[model samples]
Target: MPAHIGRPVIRLAAHRVTTDALLDHIAATCRDADDPTKPHPRLGLWKRLIRNTGVEQRYWTRPLQEATAPSSVGHRAGVAFGDALDLAESAARDALDVAGLDPGDVDAIVTSHTTSWTVPGMDVHLIERLGLRPTVTRIGLSTLACVGGAQSLVHALWHTLARPGARVLVVVAETLSTIYHESETTPQSMMYRALFGDSAGAAVVTGLTDETSADLPTGFVALDPLELVMPNSRDRYWGTIDDEGLHFDSTRKAAAAATDAVPYITDWLGKRRPEWAIVHPGGPRIIDDVVTSIGLAEKAGRYSHASLAENGNLGGTAVLDVLARTHDDPPAPGSPGALIAFGPGFTAAGVYGAWI
Candidate 1:
């Protein structure tokens, strides 16, 4: 009946790059190169998706090619890997500062991103740059999509459970607009915008003397991990890069698959009797499907809708954004809450955690 779990502690919370700046840059640079009569590439989008995506704004690491790492926007897409590194590192540092913990204190580092990959990835790079302990563990997630945070937390929990007093750092960097392909308007492409935005989130989670998250120090939020291995008949979500930048695929069947999950989530929630629902604000439809299916339309719906309206879908950062919003000031210790998220691989992950 108690939801307290995980090596609970949110030592610090940090973010970098204003979402508005990224969105504005995206709008200014969206060139419709294929617009026939107009001969203007900026006018090509079939509809004004920037507004429709419900993204208040997003973050970007300069024009992928235009920033530090030289890039040929016409031939190759996005800023050079080095440029992305700069942004990611800065965000991570901000998190460290807020945490009031030195890089030396972190025993592990976890990073999540969808737009770009690094030769060493952000985790190793951060460890080297921040001068963390040589033996620090690093977990990098690129496949989980919107569920990246939950997945990373699951791994963090395991790491902490195995060892005590060890701290873990989480960094989620999303530069969605960088992958925009100007040449496409397929349904898949259109729908993706409704679920992506550029942003970064970082926090510290660690092991302590206590068993439950409610015992975490001030400024920490915790949730339980309800690991779900939902393998479907086929790929429910996927992404690709082409002349149009990056395109995402979310089949109608995926939306339909939502129906199949209701029973499972219903049984899961019924057992816990969650007080607050931190469902991934994946978008209007994903939120609707889950809540309606589980019959938490009124309770979880409030937080899900709030996250969607305020920040669009921030890939790995979506669930954390929800957690950040729902946290109380005089934080109620042991208050029950549910964390649920879905992503590619037709995967579903949920956790139950109580506030400290």
Candidate 2:
């Protein structure tokens, strides 16, 4: 826990989505009957209930029906392991290009996303592709859902500091185009089916010593970075495979349970300025309720709206994507911004900063 301070220089970053393909799936398969206004009486109640939540658009790796596992594995995994990494690599390369650095320059790696699985995970494969130093360390996280990217960045920042002149890579890939549940009977299944989307994002966080800081443009400066762990054990949010198909447990209680921790959040944020909060866009009511209790009435809502409109619930990468969009266009070397996210176990990660 370095007493959070200074801005982080982001050397590179990129994002990807299967846009044309995803729009086709939504138009053809989701069905007009799901539209509440154009309900098909014969199509039954649930089938005709439309979700025109203004996300008239979203990207996916492939159509839902096409995202399937091999014959031996049986059924669709939504987005398979290899496909997800393929996208992740594309994103990583793009970021590296922006940074004007090669893979060998990277000293550490942090990979995020909870919607899909990789055996050795994305970090291992990326390390091989980029020819990173053999000593490069890796951090692989799961179950953080949309908040994971910022969390991963925080992890990278810590490692980079321990060894001066080190550059850490943060990669987030989510094919929520995959968190599927064959059985659409339960509220949980229906909620996820209509919400999750696929997308990948990556960035490089490089260290800036006094000499280096003078030569670089100041980027989003970091405030205090904090991670709160829940003492009580609970598996409220997770994914599964069952008779109902590849189901999600975006359990009904996730938000309510998260609300129970509001007191802790306010006191925590009080250490700095809650007026500059960058809250995750969990959903409409989720953000609203959380902010209401935490007293971030004016500040906590900026990222939530943008996150929903641009990419939907990106699972683990939402925070990073929104930060890129919200920070000043030509951010000075010394600008300040706050970063925060929430996830399963009701844990939270927060960081504050200034540009360069």
Candidate 2: RMSD to truth = 5.1
lDDT of 2 by residue, 154-270 (tens): 786777567655677788777775655432445555456556666677777766665445544335545456677666735667656654244567555675755766666667667
Per-residue lDDT over 1-356 for candidate 1, one digit per residue giving the tens place of the 0 to 100 score: 12222221221112233445444444455444565334334333523544555556433444433331323444334343454455567766766776667888888887876665456676777778778888888787775667787777767766776666567787766655555553444656644643455566666776655453333445434444566757553467776655434557767677666556667677776676655566787766767777666546565667667767665677777777666666543225666666788777766777666666
TM-score of each: 0.77, 0.78
TM-score of 1: 0.77
Cα misplacement distance, residue 235 of candidate 1 (Å): 3.0
Index of the highest-TM-score prediction: 2
Kindly report which residue stretches of model 2 are placed more than 4 angstroms away from their true locations once superposed. Answer: 1-54, 64-79, 233-235, 243-246, 289-300, 328-336
| Candidate 1 minimal-lDDT segment of 10 residues | 4-13
Candidate 1 residue spans exceeding 4 A from truth? 1-35, 38-53, 56-59, 62-84, 210-215, 218-223, 243-245, 257-259, 295-299, 328-332
Report the C-alpha displacement of residue 155, candidate 1, in angstroms. 0.8
